[model samples]
Target chain A: MAKVVIEALVARFPGDVYDPYEGAGGDDCAFVQKSKIVEVCRFLKTDPAMAFNMAPYITAVDYLGAEPRFEVVYNLLSTAHNHRIRLRVKVPEADLELESVTTVWRGANWFERYCLDMYGISFRNHPDPRRLFMYDEFVGHPLRKDYPLRGRQPLVPEREVKDIFRGPGPVGRD
Target chain B: MAIEEKGLGERDTGAAPRSAGERPFEGQHRPETYDGPLDAPLGGKQMVVNLGPSHPAMHGVTRAVVALEGETIKEMKLDIGFLHRGFEKSCENVTWGQCFPYTDRLNYVSSIMNNVGFALAVEKLCKLDVPLRSKYLRVATAELHRICDHLTLVAAMGLELGAMTVFLYGVEARDLIYDRLTEICGARLTSNYVRVGGVSRDAPDEWVEKTLQTLDRVTELRDTIDALLTRNRIFMDRTRGTGVMSREDALDFGFTGPCLRASGEPYDVRKSAPYLVYDRIDFDIPVGAHGDNFDRYLMRMEEMRQCDRIVRQCFQQMEPGPIVVEDLRYVLPPKPLVYGTIEGVMAHFKLVMEGIKVPAGEVYSYTEAANGELGFYLVSDGGGRPYKLGLRAPGWPMVAALPHMTKGALLADLVPTYDSINMIGGEVEQ
Candidate 1:
């Protein structure tokens, strides 16, 4: 069932897309070149036959020792066609930036921000490139494999609340 | 004059109708302080107001910074993650089976659904078929949780929107279900009752009968709340045209579940890709036409009725069989067999020491959760610990689109809009 979608994509971007891997659950996944990802996404959305309209989830996985340290994943769904495709783009650690697909699908806005916050993979030209989950003062991308599970972070002093009923009292240190 | 004509309870929602994208929230910001005369006339600028990371009216720990021009909202920026405990990071470090307790907290309101979703994803990766009876149980329990989730949404929505009776009725019905669920899973909330291959236990003989009786009372309460809010003039006037998201925008913003269905998209995960025994069950997906708050409320009401029908049918169609899958690698052997047989002891030891061995691959399993499509994108590296567990919390996208939805609507309208989205911060912030 997913083979037909991959065939359509291959026919369209024969030069750009390669290494189509069929997942164990029969979901078709194809890796697109980082440079042409947004173009591929635009085509996928606008094309009638492959109208992958909704971008449900976009996340990143970091391989600590691998050549391309991070892989950004886009899980695209098409309600019109009742199908979904997984799009992957590998990014090297040195150059951890890729074109954002928020323009292709507005829903990708927060997910891209999340990827940036968690994996330190920047999305170029993102409308709002602020961290989605972590605070602005957060030191590192917490989701990276290198980040320790119980790593200590610098905490700011609690602000003095003068007119509050139940205040955040002083941190007791003898 | 218009306010005097209809008063607060009956003011038309479309009194100040603005076009789709006409600088509603775009390019609107509170200006920097001005150095004017001490008694100078007031500069009519949009006032910035912050609502809850801990405010009483807020459903969860989320902060919305809104720029208000008069009573209408000119812009809104949502600051989430106050409740994020790094669900994906924790799940990645833990064993596949150990992840259930963590998934249980993702949407703590309907934790069983999260367990079911994760289990389904792992089962898909392992290519294991769940037992028929367990499938029925999963569907039934999931629907029950769906009702709980909707009840929470409706109750909170009512409490904020000046309908205290609706909140009371909704919570009472939800409590009745929770009592039965406690009997089944030994917990009121966060039931980690689903395992890799199947569920934790079967429904007791009388459990089905008790649940059926509870459903009748729930139906009565639901109908009462429906009567109170469905046609109430104030509820209609407040919600009729505010928070209007069009069909195109809803799809474009990746809305799913009841909210998506309310926007006229009949794309239910259960109906689109029937997993479990949903194919055999007789039920309908109630789709809404208007993409407004009232329609969203109505969608939940109708979907609850559908959920009731589904639960009843699952019990009737269920056949007597082993509740858990026979796969020893995934399921723990019964205590009697574990103490008696050497094979059982070996299986139990191996399973306890080293979790179920799932083949290395990735699968994005989605289910029709109470809020919408709850998806878990899991990548396994042929090990006990998962490589990556990307949680697609259904509320994430909905909360992301809040600014867009409430761009030009009144600040008061934000309550119902937030309620209808049903943004459970445990899942959304995670």
Candidate 2:
């Protein structure tokens, strides 16, 4: 099933794509270069035969000891074709960045933001590039392999609450 | 001046500006200074209100910073993650068998479905085919959880819109279902009944009869709710045309389950990708046209009936057999055998000591949860614990689309809109 999609992907951008690799449970996965991810994803989504419309999620896996330290994964589902394919982009530890697909799929906004928040892999063209699940003051990406499981950092001092109602008769009156 | 004249004079004065450092009369009030376009239509800036991190209308710990132009919401930003417990990180740390309990907390409303989804993912990775009886039982449990989930969602939506009777009726039916579920699995909300290979135990004695009785009660309650809210002018007025998400936008937002179905798309995982015994069952996928709050409400109500049909069919067709799979590597031996036989004791010891070893692979398994598609993407390096587990929460995308849905809607419309989406905090944050 994935071979057909891979063939189409290869037909369009022959040199930019790699042969489909067997993912877990025999699911087909095709790896593309980090630089060409956005263009490839745009083609995959817009191509007539492969209408991979639904961008279910975008997540990252930290292969701590592997050659490429991180693999950013995008799970795409084609509601029209009823077929699913996973796209993986490998990023080296030193250069932890990839082009964002938010322009292709608006739903990828939060998913990309979450990937940035968890794995500390920056999406180059992401719109709202801020920490999603953690505060801005949080020190490190918690999902990284080097991060300790129970590591805790000191929190910034709590902000003092200002009294909104200063002009008053009795303070508690309605 | 006389009291009546004083009141008239005060009304005439009307927000009069006070002199600097001059104290006004005790009963007089002053308005805040506004610094904006002097020729603005409303003569002031748009009011920015924090709808919640603590507001009642917000079903969970979510904050929507709404910019209001009078009563209408001009723009809104949703801030979630208050309930984030690092569930994925936690899953990576736990063993395969140990992760089952944590799955229950993912979608706590339909927790059994989460367990089923996680189990299916692990089972797929291990290449373990669950037994026929276990499959049927899983379908039955999942459908029951769906009923509970939809009922709670609709009931809560009704309550938020000031319809108390519907809430009571819906919750009452859910309580009966939960009672029966407690009989099957000891827990009510988080029923950790599904194991990796199969269910933990078979149906208790009289389980079939009890389930039938509960189904009857649920049918009656659903009918009551329908009659009360289906055509109720107030209910329709509040929900109809509010929070309308077009089909294209809904698909683009990656909506699934009832919310997506409400947008007139007949995409159901049970039908599209038939997992378990859903392929064999005869049930209809209820869909709606407008994809508004009312349509979502109607979609859930109709889906509940379809769940009842699925549950009835499963109960009738379910053959009496061993619920748990016979794979000793994954399943524990019976208590009697463990106590009596040396082989059983050794098997139990080995099973408990070394959890089922999953192959080096990855799989994405999703179930049609009450709110939407609850997917679990699991990556294993042939170890006891997962290398990485990504939980694709259905509500996360729906919550992301909230600002889109409520942009031009009124402040009162936000409550029903939020409730209609049925965003569970546990599921969203995870």
Candidate 3:
């Protein structure tokens, strides 16, 4: 399945497949242009032989001191081909916006939202762009490299929930 | 135990209160306040529901703030980190070798895979090769671990549906595997067995023989479980069409392992991305056609049977030799050298204190874990500690797709659908 996608990518983008990031043991190994991401992912999903219909999940890596600083990695696997492809988009700390693949893969909705909330990456065309993991009041993305190692920030208070553990006895005296 | 069907109504996290038809897991208890949003639409008709970091159906302490209307969940925003213990940040502070025990907790059930993944990452960083004996030993223990994980999931899925007996049976069988693990390694749950280049120590003769004997017992127990649930009308009916995710849906969501295979795809990482001795071994990848909840259940059962075969094969192909590599830079010196020789003692002390300096490189190593494709993506900056570490947790993807799988289904079906995912806490907490 990845062979077909790589072939198609090479055919369509010419030199894009041999992008600098694809070099062996490179820091930005899986890097691909953010502009062509949605198109490539759509082709991977729709192509009958490489029918990778699910956008399973997206994870972000924070290389704070490294060249690119941030990497938004997508793990796409095809049920049809039983093959997997790791697509990475390297963005500097200054610019984090990437085209959202949710339009092509509906399952990417939550996965991309997570990348946005945790790493503070902006998925440009995300259908519902609200926070997924952190609350609305969260000041910074927790997964960022610059985020404090030992945070002095205020912690979110636990909600006072109904007592689902009540019995006919003292709660904590035992 | 009395099974209470609590219909907490639907709470969606994305939008204004919509009709109940759009919401999933309606009537389910959520965490936090589901009160009308402060920016409620003009008519002010939105009702809030909180699914929690403590709800039973959450699989773990994962909270979700859902907005609802009637019985429909309008939009659901998840609230996690209630179970986060700072594994990644802590790994940076600890010695390189000390991190093995912690990896066991990640996807708690499949400890061996987590251990193997971490060991592989460190091995790549250190450029050390494990002994042939250690490789076979790792495979043997890993296969056993996979069996235990599958059993636990099957039992948990049964218990979810009020089938207490099946849960007990599976738990009992798991106890034997736990005992076997305890015999081999000192601990049962956190078997910090894998070291940087190899294992902590070679498996004792008695332990290996005992594991094979226990496996024989496990086969009988597996057959009983098979007979009980395989064709049971109730089990079949409930799971047949429940949580029907297509092959396309499974792959698009980046599903792997049994979940993807259950959807009729034969993409096992053991075969596709063969590592360790998986390529040398011959085993079949069990697949299902419908990709329903039932297929997931049956696929897991068959996979466990195959794991038994793999374990037997590892034992038959076992070779005796030094388990740890001879490289003093990568692996600590032997016990005699560490205890008697000054250089060996100093090397051990240095490794324990400062940790080994790993070459600057990044690698994504994945193994066929019981749940699915368990991947460890580690980034090293030519330092003693890892610069960035991430896991492509299979459970995260499975749980993320829960809403899509349950959207139109009745609230009662949600529990079984969730159980089929077999998601443990470590991966989802992040």
Candidate 4:
């Protein structure tokens, strides 16, 4: 896996793979430029030896005190070898823009959208950039560290909700 | 106002109309926030149907506003957070020992798995090794939880399809297992028996014998149900070709557990990840060909049989020894020792008051819950409390894949598709 990641890096970026963290079971992860994740991932999936065929999950960690305050981790699995790889990509809390891997793995579309919604991360050229959990009226991201749990917006009036009922018969249960 | 009115489609025209009948409900149909102009780009007319943040058959307070072209869903926008009670944030505020009870509510169907996952995460961060006996007990309770969860799924699906008999039979069988669980732990649903380093207490010898007996009956019932449903003409017609998901599509959508396995992927976490006593247990990871609703249903039934096999294996191979490891720093001193011995009393007091201080480390712990690979990621900043805790819930992934599964399919197939996934809203939102 190290050999594949390293080769993918060298072949694609020539000298972009830097500061590699090689774990047990020959899993190779490197701190590549955030811009190159999409390109690298596309190649990694298509690359004959690597074949990082499945995207298990994608999650972001807030390293508030660290120099790089945010890190996105991707867990990838290969059905061919039944091996797993953990890829870490670091980004600053201030500038959390990273390329979306939706082009490479369609499974990442919702996850990337969720990360964007909750953590206020920016995904460049995402297919559908919409808030996931929060409503259209919600102003700020809910999952960010600085975002307060309490809301500033006033609750919707009961009168407003009552107006929306238009069915003839009893709606739901009587 | 209460008034006497004659029947035959209301003969109250002579009497004054009630105040409630005079009001007309009318309002502007505009969203609270508008980002841009509502102009279409050469598209067909779209009607919207909102499927609840609070509606029946949503499982919980989850809503999806789906745009439809006639009866077909053109696009869907999922609205969540009705059940987000900040359980993860609460995990930080509570003591390590106190958090076990809270984990019970995350996936209420499979509380034992949640306990095991949360405890395992903390244990890994603290670098605490559980005793061999503790491992066996964890496996037993976890598998039992799996059986119960799968039973609920099958029964719920049966109910949705108007198979009231199947639903009742499934629940009756599950109740027997729940009774066994109650014997082992005082609580049936919210069994916070899994402690950080070990279980809350050792299972009584008679309780184990009873559980084994209950499992024997449960296996028989599961086989009977499988036989009843697998070849039934109506069951096959209703489920066999309904909500089919291709293997490629299933993988692309991140579908796991029986949903993924039904598409012919053998990615069981017990076999692949090998956590707890799973490495020692002998069981098969069942897979299906068509990835249809029936295949998903049948796979879960087969899985219950495997669970029975695993529980029996635990009982036969489990050695009688100390269930809790002798790590006083992590595991609390025994109750008898705490009451009788002075040193043990102080140890227990300190553990209770100050809480166990896990070292500064981040670890991702994965356990095969009833749903799928339920993972708990804990980051501790060398403090007594966790800096951040994230639960990798399986329900949301299945929910996220709903659009893919339901698209181009009949609107009526929606219930069967949703029920087969058995997504508990708390599991997704939390």
Per-model tally of clashing residue pairs = 0, 0, 29, 2
Off by over 4 Å in 2: A159-174, B1-41, B340-343
Compose the digit string of candidate 4's lDDT tens values, residues B94-130.
6788888889998998898899988888877776778
Scored by lDDT, the top model is: 1
Model 2 per-residue lDDT tens digits across residues B1-430: 0123324333323212112242222111112355677834564457778777988888878888888767778889888888889998888887788888888998887888989988998898888898889999998988999999999998998888889999999999999999989999999998989998899878999998999999999999988887777656577777877788888888888888888988988889888988899999999998887788888988888888889999999988999788878877788889899999998898788777766788997787777888888888888898778889999998888888888888777888888889999999988888
lDDT of 1 by residue, B64-183 (tens): 887776777888998888988889898888788899999888899899998888889888889999889999999999999999999888888888889999999999999999998988
TM-score-based ranking: 1, 2, 4, 3
Query: Where does model 2 sit among the CAPRI classes?
Result: acceptable
Give the fraction of true interface contacts kept by model 2.
0.60
Candidate whose DockQ is highest: 1
Alpha-carbon TM-score of each model against the true structure? 0.90, 0.90, 0.83, 0.84
Best candidate, TM-score: 1
Off by over 4 Å in 1: A157-174, B1-43
Q: What is the lDDT of residue A139 in candidate 4?
A: 72
lDDT of each: 0.85, 0.83, 0.73, 0.75
Q: After superposition, how far is residue B17 of candidate 2 from its true place, in Å?
A: 52
DockQ scores of the candidates: 0.46, 0.44, 0.24, 0.26
Candidate 1's DockQ is 0.46
Q: Give the lDDT ranking, best first.
A: 1, 2, 4, 3
Residue clash pairs of candidate 1:
none
**Residue pair clashes in candidate 2:** none
